[model samples]
Target chain A: MLATVDQHDDTSPEIGGIAVDRLRSIIERVERLEEERKALSGDIKDIFAEAKSAGFDVRTIKQILKLRRLEPSAIEEQETLLDIYRRALGM
Target chain B: MLATVDQHDDTSPEIGGIAVDRLRSIIERVERLEEERKALSGDIKDIFAEAKSAGFDVRTIKQILKLRRLEPSAIEEQETLLDIYRRALGM
Candidate 1:
């Protein structure tokens, strides 16, 4: 019930000396980014639909995109680690 | 020299049944999203600066945000896994 804005009263609780305005601004900004992220994700899904129409494997394409983001050395290192872990687990 | 847009000539190579136009569109969209993500991250950093100015631990705040994103059960499982791994490594 403390939704009162622009008040200098003790009723307005500021936890740990955090300014309510600043906290609200940060939250609003993050929410805006989250909205944009959701839109971008939808766009990505649309692209996946297009790719599927062109006979592309969506899962493989996603994997390729993720792998392309990684450095070649990093990919190699990860593969080596996976091998080691599997060996250790007797898999 | 292979940036010849709008030509159906054999000089425009299509790799592995992938449409060059579609591929370019996908890459452009991903790049745009990447740029937006970078900008959003900078905005988040600005919020961290504001928080720090208000006597908050930026690192701890970052950790709290990350932990907040995870489901409670998932976090508990991750903590259990970490403990198990640490014990296995004798750390």
Candidate 2:
């Protein structure tokens, strides 16, 4: 795969000279990163399944993901809600 | 802006007929949504500044945003850390 990438880089010089090389390098790096991302995603899915098997509230996990996407203040609001929920449960 | 958008839509009908109208509507909707997004972003940033002035750990808020981008299991890990942090601080 690396050899193929290097060969493609060599013959594709007519595309845009050095800029094409740079773009190719960036695209290759991104492709590698995407593969790593997919692997990590699968690992996370497995962990969630494990947690479900262990009887944790999976819905709370989903909520955590949703809250995590918000801005800082929004996250603080979510944390406050979590605190309230924990307190109400005497945990 | 709405008038300009409508005029553009009317003149651009040769681009693709009904599909052009549908595309124009979608683009107009997106433009409006983008304006709303900017307003909301400004509001959230102001809220964060206020929270910082109130002496909250802004890092946690940033972390929350980062975690929110992750999958469910990754979010669960972040919440576990938050739970531990809260308990340690006696909050």
RMSD in order of candidates: 11.3, 11.1
| CAPRI classification of candidate 2 | incorrect
Locate the minimum summed-lDDT window of 10 residues in model 1 chain B.
B1-10
State the lDDT of candidate 2 residue by residue for A16-90, as single tens digits: 234566677899999999999999999999999998899765666665566556886976675686565445545
**How much of the true contact map at the interface does candidate 2 reproduce, as a fraction?**
0.00
lDDT of 1 by residue, A1-91 (tens): 1223344755555755555665556556665666676677777778777767766667766776778889999999999999999999999
Task: For all candidates, state DockQ relative to the true structure.
Answer: 0.09, 0.05
Q: Give per-residue CA lDDT, model 2, range B1-91, as digits (tens).
A: 1222344555555432344666778999999999999999999999899989997556666755564578879666756865754455454
Segments in model 1 whose C-alpha atoms lie over 4 Å from true places: A1-18, A73-91, B1-12, B45-49, B52-91
Measured on C-alpha atoms, candidate 2 has an lDDT of 0.67
- Where model 2 places Cα greater than 4 Å from the true spot, the runs are A1-15, A19-26, A58-91, B1-12, B18-22, B54-91
What interface RMSD does candidate 2 have? 10.0
